[model samples]
Target: MSLRTQLTEILPPLLPSNPSEAIKGTELIRLARLQLNGAYSDASLRYHFSIMSCDPASPIAKVEKGQGYYRRSAPVPALTGAQELLSLSQGRLDDLSSDHEAVDSALERLRKFRAVVTRYYEVNGRFPYVFRQAFAQGASLGNLWKFPEVVLVDWETGDAPDEVFALDPTMLSLKQRLGLPPFRLHAARLRIHPSLASFREDFFQALSASMWAQGGELIYAAPVEDEALADGLRRLNAIFGVGVISFGLTAQALDDLPRAANILNAHPRETEALMDRLQINRIAAPHTRQHIDWQSLDGLRRESEEVQHLIGWLNDCVGKGRAEAFRDEA
Candidate 1:
């Protein structure tokens, strides 16, 4: 059978309408290579398929262009073009079977992860502890004093704690007795100066540059909402030419803050007096502490574990499936 006839049979389901001329032109180049003892020149191939460069409708064209966007860290365009290619081939390009529900589930999980990361960044002004801890130590000067530590809870893992308590890292073994979830103990040391003078400026600049290059916005977490704070943020946004989204503490944060405060306050007499003055209920003794909802925190931990599992499964499937498909084709 002619190469063209064989390609015609194999190509249609994969490239039914090559509006960008990528499939047709590539097939023509392959045919030329076959006819010329597989010795076609680069110039010939380029000349034959050059038109595909200008046509964005082809899956191959999208993939090629999407690679450039990805290299430039332009995720919006890169993913858009990638999705286009995936749609055109019905995901067969990835060797994904039509019945691959796992693939769909993994993709959905990935989307959820992206959303969680984005929301966390908006609220916390940084990535989660998992993403930042590896570089946190190396990115700052350890000789100058300990960096300010920020506790980041996985957004999927429930609400972020309102206040961070100082704990001896070595004493983390007491987490179960303290009623703290394992994930809540993770912390990332921030590289901000203690004076808090240039921290905002430097952070905003870095965040703005990153978002501009990668297609995201810099968000600031506002600990509290007030007219004065809102106006100041607006002015800063105007001056920097970037939007600063303000987020307040989560319900969980509000509820947990008082409890954390109660634990950290060494002077129980003063705390009791302040609570009485403020008409706030005082926490009971440690042994008689109110029953907390451990289920919510447990659920968060489960989600984190599931996300990691899905990520590994997806990576393994894509790598092995693509390799096998390539070997079969060859």
Candidate 2:
């Protein structure tokens, strides 16, 4: 048997399923050798592990945040997990499998991912505005194409949470005179998986939703491990200017995270602990326009009550001469 074929059979039972307890390359190599039929150098064994880890069909997976390998989870039927959430949100549970446990698991992973994405931006100095109503039950499915789940506002300066940082009147006026908006907004579309079949749909959905924003981003919970999938995403990005990023999170890793509420409300120390688990990779940089498409935004504002609330929040911040994080209650 080929080395890769041999290793495939050898790795799964030997590998840990949890990412936190990932075994180092050397340790794995030593253990893998025990089952080997022929001589193989450490370099050769390590190379096979790295390469095989990228294949979804392969049993081996590399930890994104640390040094080690883990057993990849068996493929879930709805690999992307988006459709499961969509079906549940639309109250079409009957359309899904009779395995309601799997459905609930998918939904929890989706929710946790959203919370992680939100907290990731918050700690990184970008203020996030969530559009819950767009995804709420009874909302039209078309909203997926028309609205981003989150709008990231970069105010250029701020530190304290919910604490206001004064924007200088002089600088604000100067920016206005220069025809530059005081801040930039980038609309983001989040997905739990990256697949060749569905990525184009994912990319264009982000593009369609971000027509009114400065730029657009497509964020994935898992790594863009497949070369073909990565290349396809890059080609689309080159033409469309929408950014692509992978959090290096597998479905299993997301499942290991704290509940969505706990992730969102994590204290600094706890947040850091959570952040350490991520392996962030930027597949393509977003091309941010100098100005937002205000005309398109105005048109949207007329239709979406959520958009109106978003604008109202921004206006409140500007009026107060300080930027504060968006609170659902606020």
What is the lDDT of every predicted structure here? Answer: 0.30, 0.81
* Cα-based TM-score, every candidate: 0.22, 0.73
Estimate the overall C-alpha local distance difference test score of candidate 2: 0.81
lDDT of 1 by residue, 235-322 (tens): 5545543333323332232233333324233264644433332211111101111232345324433534432332343234333321
- For 1-330, candidate 2 gives per-residue lDDT tens digits of 999999999999999976678888999999999999999999999989878876768888776554787776664344323443762232222234567787788789888999999999988878899887777757677888889988999874443454446665776678879988888899999888776546777898899999889999999998875554677789999999999999988977988899999999999999999999999999999999888889999988998888998998888877887878887774
RMSD of 1: 25.9
Off by over 4 Å in 1: 1-130, 141-203, 206-216, 224-226, 250-330
